[model samples]
Target: MSKPRSLDKSTKEDVSFIDRQPDQLTNQSVGQAEPEVPTGSDCAIAQQSSTQNINALPVDVLPPRLQEIINEANICLGFPKDYLAGAMLTAMAAVIGNTHTAEIMPGWKEYAILFTALVGSPGTNKSHPLSFAMQPLIDFDAEQAAIFNEAMKRYEAAMELPPKDRAAKGYDTNPIEPKRVRFTMQDVTPEAVHRILSENRRGLVLVSDELAGWFKNFNRYNNGSESEFWMSVFNHKAAMSDRKSSQSGVFIRNPFLCVIGTIQPKVLTELAAGNRNANGFMERILYVFPSVQSKVRWNRERKSPSFDIAAAWREILSRLIGIVPAVDSCGEIIPEDVPFSPEALDRLFSWQNEVTDRCNAEGSDTLTSIASKLEIYAVRFSLLLALADRACGDEKKLIDADIVERAIRLTEYFRVTAAKVQGIVSEDALTELQLAVLSELPGTFTTAEGVAIAAKCGMSERSFKRFIKDRKGVLFVHSAHGNYTKL
Candidate 1:
């Protein structure tokens, strides 16, 4: 018999995300100057440069304290600030989910846990920043594990006693199962994850250094049940774990799983071709693909991050982890509700209407669905930013317009990045012959030229036309007279 393969194993070379990516982002410095935002009828020019603005990190978009953390990771250590931002924010949101949840608008409550994907090639320092950011959660889990070990020891010792002696032991004879204090899990099955969430009703995070296995083996153990569970978690819907073989099946009233991970460009392309994701999986995720952040000037005198930074992250989390959950009649702990201010409510409506307008104008179901999910993410982000602005302390504050605007900026950044990711994946999906035609064609070409070029590649002009017709959105949407322009 053949040896079984490790389907979920990550790259053994320790390269973060991928082996390499050649399409480096524009090398812009942090202090690079930007043109002024026009306020009047000259806005058409502004629209054209919107992608550029979003691609560039508005360094000040973060609260001053959080920005300090970003600077240490990115500017000082040469990590991609975008990657650091997503990972750290998601971790912060996970801690918030343990007790506090934000209700952006009335009847629109959302957990702080967010599903963020840091998209970069190998050696982009994706995991370095994430490792630092997730330390608090790791420590929290360790503490809980130690506590559980001791509890189990006492329980085991009590069992060694005689029946009458065990009866006299009282509570020590029966140990309560350890609370699910582990907030982060790497590769795990659906049932295992369900069990974890059942214990830790607050939430748990799925962290993968290499996302190939997670995406590829999504439903390996349970048909489509695993995928369905993830979808439910993303929407904060009710979830249950029903297993035929196990009597310890768990049912959770609230299931929260925040996913943070990195993947190479090649893996992303493979999944894209599989088209295995539907019902807005790709749309639901926030992708961060900042270009080429490996260019750092090292000085022997430059100091690495010190204990203060670590202490700061720990201190913030220390307060957040102490969140006391409110319990219901059944003694189930309920998450506290975080809400937006009145002005924030007014602005949310305006933003929602604007997004709706844009989605309708796009005239594409895929794009529309992405916009719809982004709307929820925008609210989630506002909650995160609002928390960060207050130093992530226990004292909660209602999200305001300013916080929403900042989150919208980050959301817009993801929008631009997603388009780039899609562009690369779609172009990669093209056949060798199609890619050859594209390479041979000029930036702008006529239909006759396109057809002639297609014929050169062993394709009939009619077949070429049929193939290129639907590809307008993916490849090059034409102008008139078959005048196609490569984006």
Candidate 2:
């Protein structure tokens, strides 16, 4: 095992784990495009594509229980394993919330939080896997809602009584409404999210089925204030906001938010809107975009897994939720520090040095920004993986070398996928003629076929070859000897 390759360079090594290809789109199901149910051939394509590309998620880096869940979900629900794995990672971070942090040194600490997006075409089964991963948090919020509703009824009944009567009825003359405890929020406003975060210090996860709206709503309220709020929360920094509706401003000492959502490949341009690309917002996101082949026909005969995936996932998250966070005298959460062992720290330092060197050597700002974020993510991932192992009964006290090694592998997987997303975003920079030529080409074609298609667009063979060669990872990915695929 050699160390993971530099982010600036592509690796030719044969990695074992299989994931979808990056940026390639399969045909949409005719009319009313419904959910895609992947068949055995989907797995075959995944296995074959892993040999040719490094964009796939390294599923083996995950914990054993999570591995089982991904396998069972794919077999039973036909959800893409890549999507499930990515969603599960975000789910775990949300569950961890602000309870724990990975302390790299005296001053540097990272929380287990992430902003992830699952990018795919329609009917690729992105939503289902995400729903499956986040069901536990949803269930927890539902329970809280029920509790709040009952308390509100009591409060309302008590409020109907006169001041003296209320006291006689064992109710306070003045009543404070019970604050709702929510672990997950969807389709919410920025101020609403801030108010909720102020009430519930555990933090919140924003789960959106379509992230296009998330981008579109960036400057909706106060001209980039919402975007700045999100960027601050991404770093777990202190957040304070004062609005006209509130007498007192809302303040959070350590604001934590983990966002997970899905968007189509064509929506990548929205990411660049509002200067998100020019800023660090685009780099903070981790994208799961699997290259896929044709959709598999629905198989009614596919059997469900013997073990219950939902129950297993619930149990795992429940264990994590049960871990109580330490609080200071001021009633603020004090994140429990999980430091790396000597060996693990050494391994982490080595990986960070390599990433730093790669960032220094790379010219592409997109890739460099991604590498820098992944450096922080590397520590966050190690903490999450270690705690997840504990939730699974590993009982490890400190982050070990093996866990750090796994985190490095996991970080590399995201590094590749983020590059793929950058490639998709770069397509927005394509000229009209290039976009026209790409729209005309097949999903996969030979060089001769590409030349013929280019000629149809009135492009010469020399120019066509130059276009293909220059846009190797962006507009197209070289498939084989003289073969290319539109990305």
The whole-model lDDT of each prediction reads 0.65, 0.76
For candidate 1, write residues 135-176 as lDDT tens digits. Answer: 889888888889878877776677777756776767455545
Report clash pairs, candidate 2: 21-291
**Model 2: CA > 4 A from native:** 1-54, 162-164, 432-487
Q: After superposition, how far is residue 175 of candidate 1 from its true place, in Å?
A: 4.0
Q: Give one digit per residue, the lDDT tens place, for model 2 in 1-487.
A: 1222222111212111212222221222222233333333223322332423424566766778877878777766677777888898898898788999899999989998899999888778789889998999999999999999999998998989987899888888999988998889899887788888888888788999999878788888789888898889999999998988767899999888999999988888887788898788988988887655245457687788889989999998999988889888987888888879998898788767756664454234555677778888989999998888888877778898878877876776777677677777777877888777888988788999989998999888998888777665445655556776665
CA error at residue 422 for candidate 2, angstroms: 1.0
Misplaced by over 4 Å in model 1 are 1-54, 57-59, 104-106, 167-174, 293-299, 305-307, 392-396, 440-485
lDDT of 2 at 136: 92
Top lDDT: which candidate number?
2
Predicted structure 2, TM vs. truth: 0.80
Clashes of 2: 1
Backbone collisions counted per model: 1, 1
Measured against the true structure, the TM-scores of the candidates, in listed sequence, are 0.81, 0.80
